[model samples]
Target: MGKPLSGKVTVVTGGSRGLGREMVLAFAEAGADVVIASRKLDACVALAEEVTKKTGQRALPVACNVGEWEQCENLAEAAYEEFGVVDVLVNNAGMSLLYPSLEQVSEAMFDKVMATNLKGPFRLSALIGTRMAAAGGGSIVNISSIEAAHPEPLAVPYAAAKAGLEALSVGLAHTYGPGVRVNTIRCGPFDTDIAKAWPPELRAELARHTALKRIGGPADIVGAALFFASDASAYCTGATLALDGGFR
Candidate 1:
């Protein structure tokens, strides 16, 4: 038998770092050609080179700011132009800047957050998913956040955007399915670059809420990502998988 994702092509936004980076490597190891899209072209190139060197999978690094609708469209066109069809599309790019209070959240800040977290995914998924349905079948994986369901005051805009993303997954599934599967990964705190800035007390408090008693690692997301990207999740669609270590 072939590798699970052998001969497939995948596009992952935010593929330059953190959980996105891990997923890119995992997909390559599973024998898929990957398109790494992020705002930072240099970072994407670096990771793409690493992926090819390590796994011998073809990697295309493209600079894309998912917050922009045109960029999202260009990203899709670029991916299809290079690989013909995208077997898996992961909408992983997002941002949540800390604010002192909801009142302090500027219109610009809120718009930027929403554009990246919600609007970008909606455009990309609609573009690729529509094509997927017409061409035969494919998978669309959205990276949401636990905050979407359990909002924190510091990042209301982000939470709202993520909540919208979750809704998009379900609606897109209904519209594109039979051939396209849309699902979401509602992630919790993970030990990534962002964690380096977290205060010890805050981290400790976060850990206490998880059943596992600790935050997740970047690697922890690879398995679920692979499952969704490959035939392992053949029967699953319009679902949200919580990879939050049982946050309560």
Candidate 2:
């Protein structure tokens, strides 16, 4: 059989590294052209080149900071211009800064987290989803955090923003569906570069919280992302699937 995502055009924000990088590669392997976007143009370009070399699928790299509204618009325009249509949109750009305390968190920091996590998805989904609906249909996969539903004291602003993201996914599904499908993947800790800084003791504690007894790996997310992006989950929408190893 043909590749599941053959002929499809997928856009992934924060596509330079970590989970976003893995998704970008996975989509290309599945036979989809991709748009690699991130704040760092060089990383995006490098990944784009690798994707083309590895998968023979066209990859367009665009420098974009999802925290900025105009940049998000530009990213969409560039993708449409390059690929003509976007079959899958992955809102994966986000950040959670460590603060000494909630009282110590600055306004700028809070806004930055919210803009990247919540507002960016809102704008992108509206921009791409409307076009998808008009043209026929498409899929939007929002990467949320398990903390969105299960908040912790450490990343309060980030948790709130992700919570809002989950809400946006469901709302967009209802608004753009029948033609478009919108869903979310609420993820837990993964063994990505970010976790490299995590203390080993903390990592062990985190593992104990999950049914799997270990944090997820980059490849662990591919199946869930593919299911949502392809026809495998055609009947699903307005749903949130957790890839958190059944964290407690």
Candidate 3:
């Protein structure tokens, strides 16, 4: 089979580690030049090198804290400056800080979570999706969390932000339709680096609740990501695909 993303350029926020890193590598292997954006320059640089070595596709590493609006603009500018056009964009950068209780959650913590999970995607999609529509067409894949639907007490703010992200995807699809497609991948508990911080019982509980009886692996995300980013889902837009191993 031919490379699915040949001659395409993709940008992935948080493209340095975990699910983001996996997606970056997968996109490159599928024949797409990639722009890897994250807060850590070193990690992004290393992954960029690996991508070039493994797939011979050019990779641009950019340091960006998606929680800030200016940084999001800079990321978009850098990608366009380096690659002329971007065919795919993956909004995968997100965070949820721990707190003693909902009542004790600080304003800063709440804002940071909202900014990273919701605001950043909004800005990037606005900037790039507009260009994509004008230039012809493109795909935008948003990485959301199942917590948006099944909100837990400990993660209410994060869940709210994710819910907003899903809503944003639907709105963006309409805002840039016919030429640009926007979609969301609602993810469940995956055994990514972040899962290492999860307690054992929490992990077991999550697994038991899923029909798959196991948490997701890093590679589990590749199929859905490719589908949304490529022509495999050509007619699909404003849709949400659950990648949670049937988490209930």
Candidate 4:
């Protein structure tokens, strides 16, 4: 396919590793100027440089705590200072708490999960929404999880937070329409730290639940991210696409 996202400027959160880094690299490869933000400045910059070296595209690494409103604001401002305007947002930073139930969840664990996975996206989206609205329009892709749809009972808190994230996407799809597009990607268990809690046997067992019978790599969800960020899905919004290696 052509560089469908050429000339666009996209921002990916949590771009230090795993799916976030993969998406950043993918967008750069697709010819988009990419700005990636994460708490780790060193990792972010290294990733940014790697993408530029690999794709010959513009990439900026910014240090920010997306869960904080001020940092989110700075991320938007810095992106504009770098590229003039942002055309796409991938809210991909996340965390998971795999406790047996609500009673087993800690106060800190619950709050942290809600902040990073749900609140952070909300803060960043509001910033991107205003800019995109003024610049005509833009696209937003929220990274959710299949756990929200077909949850692991032990991960009740994570699943619940992700489910809320899905609702947030749907709500924004309408509330910010005419100038913005919002969608969710419900990703399945991937070969990432997010699944490090599972034992080898447990991981394999979970993999068996998917039609593909394997854990997805970091790059597995890039296609969905591309579709949401590019004109290919220009007519799409308020939708959720599962990139779960055929988890069904």
Clashing pairs in 1: none
lDDT per residue (tens digit) for residues 107-159 in model 2: 99899999999999899998999999998999999999999988999989999
TM-score of 1: 0.98
lDDT tens digits, residue span 46-84, model 1: 999999999999999999999999999999999999989
**Candidate 1 local distance difference test against the native:** 0.95
Q: What's the lDDT for residue 168 in model 4?
A: 95
> Is 2 or 3 the stronger prediction by lDDT?
3
Q: Clashes in model 2: which pairs?
A: none
Q: Which candidate leads the pack in lDDT?
A: 3
TM-score of 4: 0.94
User: Which is the winner by lDDT between candidate 3 and candidate 4?
Assistant: 3
Local accuracy of candidate 3 as per-residue lDDT tens digits, 1-248: 88899999999999999999999999999999999999999999999999999999999999999989999999999999999999999999999989989999999999999999999999999999999999999999999999999999999999999999999999999999999999999999999989999999999999999999999999999999999999999999999999999999
**lDDT for position 18 in model 4:** 89
Clashes of 2: 0
For model 4, residues 32-54, the per-residue Cα lDDT tens digits are 99999999999988988898889
User: For each candidate, what is the lDDT?
Assistant: 0.95, 0.95, 0.97, 0.89
The estimated TM-scores of all candidates read: 0.98, 0.99, 0.99, 0.94
Better of 1 and 3 by lDDT: 3
Stretches of candidate 1 above 4 Å error? none
